[model samples]
Target: MRTVRYSNREELEGINSRPFLANHLRTEVAVHLHSNAEPSHNARGARVIVQPGRPADARLAQSVLCSMKELIHSVSVYADFTVAPAPHTGNKGENREAKMPSIIVETAFHTNPDDARALQDPVFRTASMKGVEKGYRLFSEGKDCVPLKAEPIDGIHLSAGGSQQVDVAFEGNPQYPIELVTTNVGCPPGWTCTDGRVRIETPDTKPSQLTLRCENAGSAPMFWNTQVVDDDGVKSPPVRHWVQCIRGPGGAVASPGVPAGVEAATAG
Candidate 1:
């Protein structure tokens, strides 16, 4: 068994250092440990124990587990709560496969508020060596391993058309840049705004509509502002526009534009 501890900041850096350790345990250690043990009695195989502190740590653990699954397809997992590890042991006793050489990790310390406070700490430089040592010991003894899934992010809605600007808010790993592109509906493909902000031309022939797309250039969520301007160099009015991408089924989602006369001639 192999045990690993992860920090929120380091995991966010896009490094999967723990998976390598898990691979080492499974191929290098588990094969040998199982081969020497008798087959009639249940023999516990090696496992990977991960101790995650914050929500990000859990996510990183899931990523590491996913990578490990790709390499060692038959590894079992169990999550031992730091607060009550004893209760979970009984639950695992019912399943024989779970009795394999597993790794136990202290993902978090509820007693220490400082560890929990690290979630909001801007300078995430501290390391939880205690958790690491415990996990390593559990993995060495083949005690407890658990599987976990990553959490999802909140959705965003953006609308920019008919001389109206839109702003979209995104929260996630901030290392990535947000790229926004705007294109007019039923217009020439060449007619588009590559910049984050978009300015729409109220077509003389018909009411023109444009779509704004926001995407992350890297592995993090990004945020940007959208501004619309008219040919007269005046700021456009705040119009309620439906974000097509977020809208469901029917195309009835529309941003009713105020009459041209109602808008002030001056820039908003």
Candidate 2:
């Protein structure tokens, strides 16, 4: 999986303008699409071409093209490139031998408002990561996994006040149940843990220390965990092993976190 950002015509030229074509045929590549970065006349959208091989060329090309079509259809944001077999040999030797599947992703248009906004969002950065993951999954596994959605957390508005808390959530195949635990052996004077909950008072005082752990108790388990940091430059120990337990059919378990609506909000 590789991410190549193409912001201008010069960069695109560095790629397309390469003197040698045979040596540059990459098995996988994604060029970030941009319009304004290059002169309008210079921009040629994006193109993905599959070359035919001996025995399985036709079948592989068809499968790849179909998958690309599905990916374009599934997402509302990006446009799909016209996919076809390579036409010219260019400077390279006869364009025979199965050329690896190639895709060029055009990401931005200078004139489009939506494109302008997309460039500024962290979500857009994440989209690139997802694209790379999808490309590898498709090329190797012949299937693409559905991308996970990231929840929006307003970091600026979350206030710790004088208390500290950590939350955990689980969602996946129901067969698995997740267990979360936290241990506080060196907590400050007013900090305590009871019934799987840790409470901290005197936000101004530095904690002697704290530790957290998580584990799953099911056939198939998945784990997810994170940490909390305060205003001071102190690093809190990460909640360890927040494992997901695959419960039996028709089983359920609880998630960690302060009850919903209990979080205090601060002005941004």
Candidate 3:
């Protein structure tokens, strides 16, 4: 095997050198190993970053994540997507520009003392290599890497006529994006749903579906049920969420202009 290295701060100059290595030598896949930093000092876990919608890349990422999870035994790990968009541009330059399917392996958070210690262990790195091996085997044979499913995620609250974001958890390799459809028949006027698909950037994270809005509040609570459809045309059982505009201290529905203190209260 041949090894190539990038100079420090090469990215600062807009230089992506990893592609040159792959072009010069015939390679199957490229793996970029790295780490992440969280705002919270206690955040911990390992996640693989891959190009979205690429089955082989996704499988490889899932494999690394599952393997690392077993090795750490304590920290949670999952596969994440490296989507091409602003801020992230989907992923690091190495993965996006490579000649072959590529992914970035975020070992763990250095800010977390526990993870920092884990990063120093030779066994930890070994586990990562093993994970890649496992994924490579499946990817080569066109095996199923991740199971498919749609998971309703935490709901966001909004005042009547206001908008809020809805999201879902996705699993498995999908040839298409996850579609969200409102199943509630009583969705009142001003009720509109947009951005009907789950936009995922990584694994172990929820994908935003769309904004839910209502034109007005009712004397009673309003209900909404959503159907999540996966890439293979598989549909998840309807998931429910709701919102009520509070009129006063009690749980009564309020008029459009009533002040919603919303104390210790959550709206679906």
Residue 27 lDDT, candidate 3, scale 0-100: 85
The sequence of per-residue lDDT tens digits that candidate 3 reaches over residues 1-268 is 8976757666733436775577567688887777779989877666677766566666666665653443333222312312111112255666767778777777678888877876787756565555556556657666744534457545444554454555555555543455555544343344332222333343434544555543333433556566655443435556666655432332222111112232222233
Candidate 1 deviant stretches above 4 angstroms: 1-60, 63-162, 183-268
Better of 1 and 3 by lDDT: 3
Clash count for candidate 1 is 9
TM-score of each: 0.19, 0.30, 0.42
**Local accuracy of candidate 2 as per-residue lDDT tens digits, 1-268:** 8988667857655555432353366534322232334444334322233333332333333333343333333344544433232321122212232143333333444344555554565654354334434444454655533222212221111112222233332221111112223332232222222223323333333331222221222233223333332211112334443332333332222223433333322211
Worst 10 residues of 2 by lDDT: 170-179
lDDT of 1 by residue, 34-130 (tens): 0112333332222223332233233333333332322122111111112222212212211212212332323333234543443233322112222
Error of 2 at 263 (Å): 22
Q: Per-candidate RMSD vs. true structure?
A: 21.1, 17.0, 15.7
Ranking by lDDT: 3, 2, 1
Clashing pairs in 1: 52-107, 77-145, 77-146, 78-145, 78-146, 102-142, 102-143, 102-144, 103-144
